[model samples]
Target: MEFRFTVLASGSTGNATVVQSGDKTVLVDAGHSLKKLEELMGSQGIAGHDIDAVLITHEHSDHIKGLNALARKYELPVYANEATWAALERHATHVPPERRVVMGTGEEVRFGSMAVRSYPISHDAAEPVGYTFTEDGYKLSLATDLGYVSDLVRRSIIDSDVLVLESNHDPEMLRMGRYPWNIKRRILSDVGHLSNEAAGEALCELMTDRTRRVYLAHLSLNHNMMDLARLTVNGVLEDRGHFFRKDEHPLRDTHPYEPTPWDQIKRKAL
Candidate 1:
């Protein structure tokens, strides 16, 4: 079995990713418009019809903006926890009955050739969670849109072969930026998005020799820069003598607005 994941698009504007195992493909998040989601998937040689499932992390607009349309367009199953499903109904009103699948955190769901398990995350949304995918012994963890990493999250992703984790902002930048005080406080709170330092600290506890790649995700457009996020994560890893390949280090996707594909890392042996 072969497992592959791609960051089709990642940022505050919209978020979406593709995870594939052989002929089975699952889309995580549909934050962009239907057209935009199609373009992004097409750029990676995938079509809307090929998506078997859509797993949502939360009900935030940046994560589920196009979920209703995408699920309706492709007749795909959309899975989320009860609260998230309830929240999604408010935003993605057009999603039909059959397509809205309710899944609970920590429940293992399987597709054609892979298994996915969602774990609780520290986001303010309605029971937000991250996911872990395992296929033929290889693991890929996706944990973005989270404020801080919890012990449960650390346990879920510790031995992952590839980690797409959040490094949302720089604390200093956020504090001094123009976003309102309440928004800033929420961001800095435990249930808010992870700052670069917080993300790196989480990585320190999660990375191991078996971990092959790390992709820093969900960066704030106005508060954080790609270089700064990368530098912060790299610095943390290096300080602990856990260096990584240039590609394996946390890096940002270049085209935040377009359907983009990052270099796909092949599944590594366990």
Candidate 2:
């Protein structure tokens, strides 16, 4: 079976991704508006009905903005932990009870050929989590919107074939940016987002021989430029002697507005 992953949109503005294993398709977070979600998915030839489920990472607006409309329109099942569901219910009342699937952290849920599990993440939102999708022994993990990489987070994503990790900002740039002090402190907190340096260091520890692709996601438009993020990460990897050739371990970039090209995960030959 073919295992594929795509980032539909990723940034502070919004965040969403698509994970597909053969016939099973899952949408991870629907932060865009209903119209924008449609356009983003349509760009990748994925219609609403094509998605078998929606797995939420947290209750943050940037992660669940369009969830109500999308779930209601497609009659799709939405999964999240109890706290997140409780927090989300206050605003996304349009989502019916029958469509809500409250899952426990670290619990595995199957969607046909795909098996997905959520791992706890330290974000400012209620019960925020990251997801890992495993199919036919191949794994695709996504860990973004996290302030720092905890031991649990590191273990959860360790041997992934493809990883979509956050490279959110440059610390110095953020410290000097125009945002209010409180907002900056929130972002720099333990429950905030990860910086480029942190992401790079985390990658050095997380990357295994099985790891092939890494997508730098959720970049800040004001504080981070794509080239700067790439350069910083690569520099870190090189400095630590963990860097590999582009073909061996390609670092891909994701856009906040468009979908990344589908990345097929192929298992290594015995």
Candidate 3:
């Protein structure tokens, strides 16, 4: 069976993505309210009961806001590193002890038919991390909420078949926008979100012909336009002689992100 994945929602307001390989279905984050999450999943023909686990990226409310509620309702397991667990335990009191699973950076967690590994990311949080899910020979990397791409990150996602990466904002738009100076500085800081230019540069280095899909995620609603982010990344790829097909829809247009078949990607692999 083909592995399945979808970015149910992605933004500052909330973030969540579903990944399924065979019987196991997992959610990457639950930043929205339980109700909103249900609505988003429902749109993709997934019910709340379908998820077997929740993998948290960090302790930020925008990523864990719905965690407690979702866990309580589904009796699902939640995975995170020690520091992130500590922070979540402090803030999300409703998650049951049995449901909290501790996973270290680079450690693989296996459930159902999928194997997921977490990698550390530079961000202002207790212990932020991105995840890579592998099934059979195919890999999908979800690396958002990162400040900048590190060597380890680049190495981890180098040959991924699908990449859901952050294109958080456009620097020019951000610098000229009305956000306060402190907020702007925080965003531009090394420990903050990745700008579109940075994301484009990183993708140019990471992407190979094997990459079948690329989703630009966690975009800043106020500082980044979807078309602009698409254009920027496309330009970078084209400049490097790696061109994405024009028929592909941007992540924003692929509402409930679905997995492209591994066979198709394999045929295009370099």
Candidate 4:
């Protein structure tokens, strides 16, 4: 039983992830157009229709843009919580009747060859939640768009082979940057995005023996650099007695949600 994941895109621009077990594949988000997504999957030697389902994290444009269109093109099922569905229903069109499965926080939803659990998050929305996927004995946890990682969210991320966690910005950079005071304040709020330091600190607290790979994600293209995100996570990891050289960290797919092998680490997923 082999488990893999991939990222279609990361950062504030767009976000998507593909997780698969053997022949079954699931897309965590579709932030790109169907054409772009199909091209990306092709680059990885996967067909667009190979995706079994689409799981949305929130209604943010960056995460939801390609969802409706992708579903239209591929006729794929979409699994999202009730509130998330309500917010997105205005955009739903072309999705088949059996394709919408409304879920809730802390509930489990099963697809072929894998079991998934959704848990509430602190993002400013109606019951936004992160996802945890398990197949065989390996676990992959996906959490982004979180303002602050709560105890419940923290506990759900434990014992994983791969973690696609968010490190949205650097406090110093965001604070000193030219963004307006209101936007900055909103970002710093509990229901806002996560800062590099905050994300690192949260991971430090939630990590365990089973947590091996960590992929920093949902970065702010405006205020943060890849090196900055990597450095922050590495710094926190080292402080918590879990250090890895920059060259030694696990990488994600070219897009978000792309999987790296559980045992190998790289700058980007292959």
TM-score ranking, best first: 2, 1, 3, 4
lDDT by residue (tens digit), candidate 3, 1-270:
658787877889888888887788889999888888888888777888899989999988878878888998988998888999888767845588999888897899997778999998999999899999887788889998888899999999888888889999899999999999999999998889998889889988887767777888888889988889888877776787775445753233222233222222232435
Q: Rank the candidates by lDDT, best first.
A: 2, 1, 3, 4
TM-scores of all models? 0.93, 0.97, 0.92, 0.88
Show model 1 residue runs off by greater than 4 Å. Answer: 244-255, 259-270
lDDT agreement of model 2 with the native: 0.91
**Clashes in predicted model 3:** 0
* Candidate 2 lDDT trough over 10 residues, lowest sum: 241-250
For 34-107, candidate 4 gives per-residue lDDT tens digits of 77777777777778788888888877777787877788778888988888887776655335657888777788
Error of 2 at 251 (Å): 0.6
**Can you list the residue pairs that collide in candidate 3?**
none
Q: Which is superior by lDDT, 2 or 4?
A: 2
Estimate, for each residue in 85-178, the C-alpha lDDT of model 2 and write its tens digit: 8889776545789999988999999988788999999989878999998988899999999989999999999999888999999999999999
- The count of backbone overlaps in candidate 4 is 17
Task: Give candidate 3 misplaced runs (Cα > 4 Å).
Answer: 248-270
Between candidates 3 and 4, name the one with more favorable lDDT.
Answer: 3
After superposition, the stretches of candidate 2 with alpha carbons farther than 4 Å from their true spots are 268-270
Q: Global CA lDDT of candidate 4, please?
A: 0.76
Instruction: Count the clashes in each prediction.
Output: 1, 0, 0, 17
lDDT of 3: 0.82
Root-mean-square deviation of Cα positions for candidate 2 versus the true structure, in angstroms: 1.2
lDDT of 1 by residue, 1-270 (tens): 667878888888999989988889999998899889998898889999999999999988988888777887788998989988887767745578877888998999999879999999988898899999988777889988777787888999898878888888999999899999999999999889998888888888997767777788888999999889888877887887877676645444544775545445455554
Q: In terms of TM-score, which candidate is strongest?
A: 2
Model 3 residue 46 CA deviation (Å) reads 1.3
